[model samples]
Target chain A: MIRIENVSFKHRATPILSDISLDIPKGGVVALIGPNGAGKSTLLSLVARLQPLQAGVISVDGLPVDTTPSRDLAKVLAILRQDTTIASRLRVRELVGFGRFPHGRGRLTQEDDAIVDAAVAQFDLTDLSDRFIETLSGGQRQRALVAMAFAQDTDYLLLDEPLNNLDMYYARALMRSLRSVADANGKTVVIVLHDINQASAHADRIVAMKSGRIIADGTPGEILTPDMLDTVFGFRMRVETIEGKPFALHQL
Target chain B: MISAVSKPSLWTGLIAGLGLAVLFVLSLAVGVSPLPLNKVLSDPEAMQLLAVSRLPRTFAAVLCGAGLAIAGLIMQTLSRNRFVEPATAGTAQSAELGILLVTLLFPAAALWVKTLVAGGAALVGTSVFLATAHRLPPQQPFLVPLFGIVYGGVIGAVATFAAWQADLLQFLSVWTNGEFSGVLRGRYELLWIAALMVAVAWIVADRLTIMALGREASIGLGIDYARMMQIGLVIVSVITALAVVIVGMIPFVGLAVPNIVSRLMGDNVRGTLGWVAAGGAGLVLACDIAGRLLRYPYEIPVGTVMGVVGGAVFLWLLFRRGGHG
Candidate 1:
């Protein structure tokens, strides 16, 4: 479980996350949906301790993020941030193998090797594993990055906009993989997503954020209503339930 | 072969080691006198000549080259900019300052004592440069190197003032222009400590490799990023100071060799560290030999040779189409 209490972040004078508090339970995909500048990515970054927390407390799996040894925390949780520029010379296989670093410190044991190979196969990157990351298209690179995070084999995975740069086909494949992993592996996946339908179709819970605060939190059916969508995105959208899943027709 | 891209292949080591061995032999054999290798084993005088000047000079060149290359690669990793190096970041200049002060205050000091003081100065200077460089907006990656050049100039200015005031401009040149002509059995042995620093680098090679992926990723991978950074700066500064003390300052071996090795072996430090060291040794040995041959008995300083060659290669690295700067 991940816990946050009175978490408020300020970048200089402006508040990025204002007095936000939330608890994420174990073993399911929880999709955070919001418009631009809604503090979704900031919240994820804070939980991962990418930056120092200004005024709050955050804990992952009962370990306080601020004081826990990074090595210990890394074994339990993995995060993949968006817009990271990697060194071009690293191959996809090498980047994915880096996920095993926290365990072996770069000397891969046979078990770690098998895990890396499994991650590559799971992400459909078996053919491209030897290729340098720079040669991959944007979508393929995104998949490799996500694969690296999965290779970490942590109980909790935090993905910040993992769907960015991915086309619809790869995007759906990635979501389905996340869904299966959440179900079979019992992994806790907290993902920040833009496409409400992707969240609706795949996520067990939907979290809506607006102006640096969580405005609504419930199952996808409860959070995907037209009224709640308007409050979060500041616009009304038609909601359609298909096969027990509620998806918003926001593009129209 | 493609698998070699992500990790160090055995071939890379074999090829680089072979080239270094050949260069080492050439370095030992090529000199003013005819101390033939096969004859030196039997003749006492030839062995003396080989042991006294030839062996030390060759080892110094190799150690200096390997050490500076490792230093340069670490600097680039810590700063995340390929153009930045010890020479650009005031490390060499700070060591120069340390040398000038020690010379002024204690003219009779041992070379090792000078190295210790100079290493301290270099550590401080490099730490300041890195701390400031880290705070600057990283989006404009070029700013760090530009800032380093200016920072180095500022430290160089201080050394120049002290040298001029003491009327020791000639003495200063001894620290600024690197050569092995003055190197003897005892004089250049401090560079062996650089070998130790390189060993330490090998021990932490994986940590350094992860560090190149940026701070967040390094932390995520459970590396103590801040501690590794301090260790990296210490390694770079000490090797640089040792080289400055023994052979003066050689430029661009660090900057050029690591970048070239990265192109071949990719950025995995464990895979590339040996190649970078061997490539450094080979490059410096080649230039030193060229310097010996260029002017005949007069013998150009190795630093002078490096200035011309390193500058040309640096220009090529900068303006080359495709590939990183």
Candidate 2:
């Protein structure tokens, strides 16, 4: 479980995240949805300790994020941030192999190599494993980056805008893979998503944020209402149910 | 579907090794007072020149070449910008400043003392550049190198002004124009220290490779990014300072060599470092040899020759990359 209390973050003098508290229980998929500048990525960064906690406390599975050694924290949690640019020309396999660095400190044993292989296979990257990352299309690169995070083998995974450049088919494939992995391995996934219908179809719970604070948190069916969408996004959207799942039609 | 890029082949290593060997022989054989191969063993004067002058010059050239290349590789990786090197990033100019200051204040200081002071100044200079770079927004990739060039220019101006004020302008010119003409046995020993540092860099090549993955990814992989960066900065400063002190400023050997090696072998430091080192050493040796033969006895400085050749290569690299960065 991840816990946050009275968390607030400010960049320079402007507040990015206001005082907020939330608890994420273990072993399920939670989709974080929000409008632009709503602090969704900031919140994820704080939980992952990508950013320092300025005015609050965050703990991952009872270990305080600020005090815990990064190596120990890495074994328990992994995060894939948005807009990561790699300067080196790394092949897909080599990039995925870096996920085991926290465990092996660069020297990979047979077991570590097997884990990397599994991650490549899991992401359907076997064919593209030897291609340089610079040559990959946007969606292929996204898959490779996510595969790297998956190879970390952590209990808690936080993905910030992982679907940025992904097409619909790849996005659905990624969400389905995330769901299966969470279900089969008992891993906890916290994902920041933009498409509300995708979150409605795949996520076990939906977390809605507006103006640096969580406005609503519940199952997708509970939080996908037109009123909740209007409050969170500052606009009205139609909500409809199809085959027991609530989908938000915000395009119109 | 696995489209593996071509790895560095054994043939490449063999060829580079053979080339270095031939260049070493040429360096030894092509000086003003050339010693015949047979006479080198029999004549005391020939043997003395080989031991005291020729051998030291050859070794210094190789070590300086390899050291600066590795230093540049580390700088590029740490800065996450290919164009950032000792010459552009103000490290070499800061070292020149240290040499000038020590030359004035402690006129009797030994060579090692000057090298150490220069290295310390380089560390400070590089640290300032890094601090400023981190504060700037990362919008344009070329901005970092442009800032480095401007920063280096400021430091170079200060060094030049100080040299002029102290009446050491001649000394400054000699030190800034890199050459192998003065590498006597005792004078070139500091380059061995640079060789040692390059070995140390090789041992930590994996850490450096991880660093090239960018800050967030490095930290996410549980690397203490700041600590690794500090180590890289220290290595880069020390190598650049020592190279500048011993051979003057060998421009673009650092920049051109590593960039060329990465183009051929990819950027995994562990796999590519040896090639980069070899390429650097080979390039410097080739330039030094050309300098010796260009004017026969008078000789152009290796720095001048490298500037011409390396500048052309750098321009080609810029255009090859479509000038985006």
Root-mean-square deviation of each candidate, in angstroms?
Answer: 2.0, 1.9
Give the docking tier of candidate 2: medium
Off by over 4 Å in 2: B1-4, B323-325
DockQ of each candidate's interface versus the true one? 0.52, 0.59
Instruction: Write out the backbone clash pairs for model 2.
Output: none
For the record, the alpha-carbon RMSD of candidate 1 to the native fold, in angstroms, is 2.0
Instruction: Please name the candidate that would achieve the greatest DockQ relative to the true structure.
Output: 2
lDDT of 1 by residue, B230-258 (tens): 99999999999998888989999988998
Best by lDDT: 1
Model 1, residue B269: what's the lDDT? Answer: 84
How well does chain B match by TM-score in each candidate?
A: 0.95, 0.96
Interface RMSD of each: 3.0, 2.6
Model 2, B186-260: lDDT tens digits are 988878888888888888887888899878888787878889989999999999888888889898988999998
